[model samples]
Target: MKTDPTRYLARLRVTPGYEKAVPAPPSVGVLIVGYRACFAAAPAAGTPIASFEATTPVQIDAGAATAMALISVERATQRLRIRTEGGTEISWEENYFSAFGDSGTQWHLLPVDPSSHGGFVIARGAWAAGGYQAVLTRSTLIQAPFAPAVVSVHNVDPHTGERRW
Candidate 1:
């Protein structure tokens, strides 16, 4: 599980045709204190977290299924805990990659405190029996129309592990 330390928005894909397609947008809620203080558009931190179940389960062979979870990690941990209500739970390191399958149970995790760092939510799920990449955005993309394109090059001395360029 790899996470972005500076990310605030966690986007997870809700794929259709797992058990059933989602008919409507699911309710999203956070479980962290001071969540609103940190993120304005994020859901209010609630007890037992918020339900992601739809009013009516829709089974579609076309279209798309998507959802976003706004979270604030005031406190940082070695790994972010991810668990589904009725599925497997796992912890992902800050920048390590991991894999998971689709279907079965919703998942959520939030750890907030002033002493902790930030992290991203990396999840793998199916949408219509296919795979897609989910993304988390802490800050909005910047548009630098007048700014020059910035290119970075790093030359490292193999034995010393020191930058040469």
Candidate 2:
């Protein structure tokens, strides 16, 4: 049943793209409305280059709902993270906040070499590990087509911590 008007949330749109490797740090423009995070990728030296965006528009604000926000991309060694207004980064993977309940954030750091067939390191953390934790799962060389050479950071116990996914 519809409890209250402020108890609902909006939908999210995630769009991804591929382009030339950026050699330097990019001048990125990010927008975070409420708990939704919008990603805008640009050139290293600062240009409106091609980009991808994932909106973390779902968040539980002082209620009994589950809000989720996350970002994922293959072959990503480094990424630009979104943070609070005063530069307080949400975490490595994403930022999550809630007044309703504590689903915290699900953090996953997967080191994957899509072009190579080798090993992987997976580290993850979440409720099972005391609410929010980030750990890696290691694996040996994998030379399979469908098998991900991906080591995933499995779960997160809280809304903190960052990693090089």
Candidate 3:
């Protein structure tokens, strides 16, 4: 029961290096294409799991080696997976978007750490209490093992919000 990766959300501007910056934010929405994976014996086993893919190619420097993109899976942990040039996959232990709409940032400051994972956050019109919403506070460039890329942003749907994948 895999879903097709066919939607275009937004054009994300990935900064350079590991340095952090809260530049002018972009209008936001989920970017990756979402899919639900079902096991052959799923009903007898457990619930089906969801997965997502990067539909848009990442924009990196001309001489950059590694490339990174933000993605998410329905009902799965908000962990990040980085693929190496040799095809090796490294998974990050943070669900960065887990606290987007937390009590602290209802209509105030919403801070997002690039290393965490969870529900995806995007810029919204109103400061709503629920849903995947947040302002781009800081984006850090993850180094080595991946690409020579400078920075990247994670945009995905909230865990408990309506499924847009």
Candidate 4:
């Protein structure tokens, strides 16, 4: 079975409180979205067996910055170079959101010291064959202290054009 296309939007919000602490850092930020595919019949739920991922860069502005990506998947075997501890081969037929992030730089996985920027994945779902459009939004704080970012996943019906979060 083939998976439907998914669109992801990453937004970086620079709050007023953050600005009061420090002016916008003169550097661009990076946003990453990752997908992990697991065997639909696997005994362990949400265990990854295969995967695909991508990233984009966003400039830190006074208010906000945004980035977007569109992706689709097809049913195919993904071979693993290294076998599992049990030496078992694996095949994945379903995909789900595995990770999301907003970082100070592309080289860093998370916001470094003095960056005050971060993000997280709030929701995830397995991709269904011939499914509706999936919309994923990640909102992150650029310089806000103790403020948590949000990541929301929604599915939009193709026929009725309705969104279900």
Tens digit of per-residue lDDT, candidate 4, span 29-141: 22223332222221122222111122312222223222212221233334444565657565542222223322121110111111113312212233221221122233222
Per-candidate Cα lDDT values, in order, are: 0.25, 0.22, 0.26, 0.26
Candidate 1 has an lDDT of 0.25
Flag regions of model 1 displaced more than 4 Å.
1-63, 76-133, 136-165
Tell me the TM-score of each prediction against the true structure.
0.17, 0.17, 0.17, 0.20
Question: TM-score ranking from best to worst?
Answer: 4, 3, 2, 1
Q: Write the per-residue lDDT of candidate 1 for residues 52-114, one digit (tens) a residue.
A: 222011211112222223222222123445566555545534324223322221222232222
Expressed as tens digits, the lDDT of each residue in 1-165 for candidate 2 is 323322222221111221232122112211111111123211111111111122122322323222221222222122446565655333232223234333322222222111122211122233212122221111111111222222222222345643221
Cα lDDT tens digits, model 3, 128-147, are: 12223221211211211222
lDDT, candidate 3, residue 143? 10
Per TM-score, the best of the predicted structures is 4
Q: List the residue pairs that clash in candidate 4.
A: none
Model 2 poorest 10 in a row by lDDT: 42-51
User: What are the root-mean-square deviations of the candidates from the true structure over C-alphas?
Assistant: 21.1, 22.1, 19.6, 18.1
